[model samples]
Target: MTKTLQKTTALSTKNGKKSPTDKNLSARAAAAQIILQVLDHGKSLSALLPEIQPRMKPQDLPLLQEICFGVCRVLPRLEWIIRLLVDKPLKGKTRIVHCLLLVGLYQILYTRIPPHAAINEAVNAARQLKSDNFRGLLNGVLRRFLRERESVLATVDKHWQTNHPEWLVNKLKKTYPNWRDIIDANNQKPPMWLRVNRNHSSAENYRQRLAENGITAFPAENPHALRLESPVSVSQLPHFAEGWATVQDVHAQWSAILLEPQNGELILDACAAPGGKTTHILEQAPQAKVVALDVEENRLKRITENLARLNQQAVVICGDATRPETWLPQAAQQITGNKSAVKFDRILLDAPCSATGVIRRHPDIKWLRREQDIAPLVEIQHQILTALWQTLKPNGILLYATCSVLPDENGRQIARFLAEHSDAQLEPLPFPAPQAIGHQFLPAENGGDGFYYAKLRKIA
Candidate 1:
C-alpha cells in the first residue's frame, strides 16, 4: 500500500517569517528533502538525485548520495532505532526533521563521519528546515544513541535481522531456499560492471587501456564484461566519449548474446530505452537491421545518443510494445519495404518488472515498490509477450528478460506463456537455473545484478 506523506509549507523562521532560500540549504538538509520525497512521496532516488546533485558542491555530491542511498538501504533499522529514541512520530511539517534525524543516525552508525559533526550538522539542518523546536530533540536523540550505541545495536540484531520491508522478506522466503543470501546482497553496495563495446575494442584491449589509465578492472565470465576494482567517473575511462565501453551489468550484457543477432536479421528491442541491450545487438551483428522501440519519447534521446557515440545505427521509434499495430506497419515498411508484413527475426522483450533483483544498485526500489505492484506488472508482461509474439517470424527467437527474481515475473510468467501458445517452445538458456523454465541470477557477493532470461522459439 502506498503511504502519502502529508504536504507541508516551505521553510520558515520560528517567528513565522520566510526562512533563507534553498541556496542556504546544507547537504544534510538537501538529503533530508530527498529522503522525504522517496519514503513518503514514493519518488525514485534515480530521478531525484539528478535533479538535486547539480545544485550541490562537487565535493558534497558524494556525501549527498551516500546519505540518501545509505538511509534507504538500512531504512528499517533506522526506523526501528527512531522508535526507541523518539517519544512520538514526527508528522506533517516536522517530518522533514524526522528524515534529518534518520540522516544523522545513519551517518553516526554507518559512515566515518564523527558523531559530533554528524549531530551538529543534523541539528543545524533542523534549524534550516525552520524546526527550531526540534533542534534540542535531534541533538539529544543522536547523543543518546551514541551513548547507548552497543546496546541499541545489539537489540536491533535480535529484533530486525533483515533491513527490508516485512512483506518483501516474506515473499523472498517463499521464493528461494537461499533467501538470506539474497537479502544480504541487497544490503551491500553493488560493484560496478562494464561491457566493452566489441565494435570499438575487445575486453582484453579495454582492460589494458584501463590499466594504462591507472584503473584496475578484471574480466568476468562474459567475454566483454570487466568488473572494476573500484568505480571511477566515466570521464576517467579511456575514450569514454567515443564509447569504447559502457557501464552495464554483467547480466544485462547477456540479452544480446541470448538473442544471437545474425547478419541481415531484423531485430526488435521492445521497451528499449537508453538502448543498452539494443546497442549490444548492433555491436554483435552490425549488419542486422535493428528497430529500437520505447514508449517514452523523452528517453528515446538516450538511445540515439548511445548509438551516435558508438557510431552505430538503429531505427529508433517511439511506440507502445503492447500495441504494436499502431506503429509496426510503418516501421516494417522502413526496414523491409513492406507495409503489410511486420515480422522480426529476433525480439528482445526487456519487460517492465518490480526490479526486486537489482535493489542493491537502486536501494530506493525497496521502499518505493509495493507487493501489489507485481500482479499488474505480470499482466503487462503478458500483454507485451502476447502482442510481440505475433511480430516474431516463424522459427524466430524471442528472449524474455527482466531484472527481477520473482517467479511470477520470470519462470512462472514463461510457463504460462508456453501453456497458452502451442507454437511457442522454450529453448534452453546458456546459464544454469534451478527452475525448468528460465535461468534466475540472484545478486551475488561480487557479481551481476539479479536478472532472468527465458528464450522462446516460434514454431512454423
Candidate 2:
C-alpha cells in the first residue's frame, strides 16, 4: 500500500526475530520487492539492485538475483500462466504479493530447487510480508501449478513464450528480417567479455593466464576482447584490481576500436557515464588527451572511479551534452592547462537511446520502455549529436554508437543526420561496416551484443 508498509512487510519477521529460514525468507523478500518496484513502481532493476543487494546476506545475494532475473526472463509465460490460475488480478496494496508469486513460479519452473521447498518457502515468504492470511492461498496456488505444470507449460509455444514486450517484438520485426533470431538471442544468457588493457598485458597473455587458473576463454576478432566460456565475478578475474583487464561486452568494446583514437589527438566521450568507453579510449591510446562528460553527478563519479581503477586519466565533467558550451571551456582548460579555445580531434558520442540491444543482459528494458518513448529519445539523440558535432574540428572523426537495434535510433537517425549536415561524411569502419548507412551488429553476431556504429568525418 504505502512505501513504509511495503518496506516493513518485506523486512520484518514474526516476533521481530530471525529464524533458521532467515536467509531464505530474506532472499525471497528482497527479490519480491525488486520485482514489485520494477513491474509496479516503474523503477530500473539495475538501479534497484545496488540498493537492495547490500541488505541481503552475501551467500543469499546470488539466489536473490537468480530469482529476480529468472522472473524477468520468462515474464510473458509466467503472466499467461498466472492469469489462467488466479481468479482475478492482484490489485492495489496486494500488488507486491503478485510479484512474490512470480518469484515463486520462477523458482518452480526454471531453477533446480525442489518444487516442494520452493512452494513452502514461497508460502513462508508471504508471512514476512505480514500477509500471513494469504499463506494458505499461496500454498494452494503453487501446488495447483505443480499439478497442472505439464499442461500449462505445453501451451506455452515460442510465439506465446517470448519474453519481449509486444512493442519491442513489433519494432524488431519491422527493423530486421530475421526478427525471430534476434528475439532468440535476446532470451539467452549474455557471454562475459573482457577488455585486456594493452598497457598492462596483451590479450593473448591474459588468455594464457586464464588457462592457468582453469578458466576457459577464447580470443575475439578484436585483439583486445576475450569472451569467457562462462561468466564469473570480477573478483575471480586475475589482475582485476590491478587493472589488467575490465569486463565489457564484445560489441561495446568496438566503440573505442572504431573511434581509432591516436596517441596525441584530443578526444571527447559525450554522455560518458560509468566510463566503459571513456576508459577504453585511454587504454587504447594512453597519451591521448580525453574528456569524459555526463549530465548526472553520481554517474560521473563512477567514471572517475573506473578511471582510477584502470590507472587512467581523463578530464571528467558533469554537464548536459545538449549545452556543451557550459562545460567545454573548463574541459579544454583541464586538458591543455590553458583557458583557451580547443576542439576535439576525435569524438565518441555514445548517444542515449532505448537500450534495445542488450535486452538479454537486462530483460527489464523490454518491460520498462514504451513505443512512444522512441520519438522523444530520437529528439534527445539529435540534440546531443548536433551540440557535440560543433566541438569536433574540421576533418576530425566522430563515431555515433548505441546499444540499440532500433532503426529509428541507429541507421535512420544517422541517415537524417547525414541529410541535415553537409559537413558530415560517412567513413567506412575497419570492421565489416554494414552497408545500411552504418555498421549494425546483431545480438551474438560475432559473439557480441546487438550494437550499431556509424563513423562520420567532419569535412574540412
Q: What is the TM-score of each candidate against the true structure?
A: 0.93, 0.93
The clash number for model 2 is 0
lDDT of 1 by residue, 1-460 (tens): 0111122232224475534434646889989988988888878777677666655677888988999999999998999889988999999888988999899999998999989999999999887777898899999999999899899888877754788888899999999999999999999999998999887889999999999999999999899999999989999999888978889999889999989999899999998988889889998999999999988786799999999988899999999889999889879888878888778999999998888888998888888888888898899899999999999999999999998989999999999999999999999877655447888889997899899999999999
**Candidate 2 on 1-460: residue-level lDDT in tens?**
0010112133335687853234544788778877887787666667777656555788988998888877888898888888878998988888867887898899998899999999888888887877788788788888999999888777765354567888888888887899988998888878899999999899999999999988889998888999999888899899999899999998889999899999999999988888989999998899999999887776888898899999889999988989988998898788778768799999999888888888888887777778888898899899999989998999999999988899898889999999999999999876653466888889963388888899999999
Q: What is the TM-score (0 to 1) of candidate 2?
A: 0.93
lDDT of 2 at 66: 86
| CA RMSD of each candidate after superposition | 3.9, 4.6
Candidate 1 weakest ten by summed lDDT: 1-10
Clashes of 1: 0
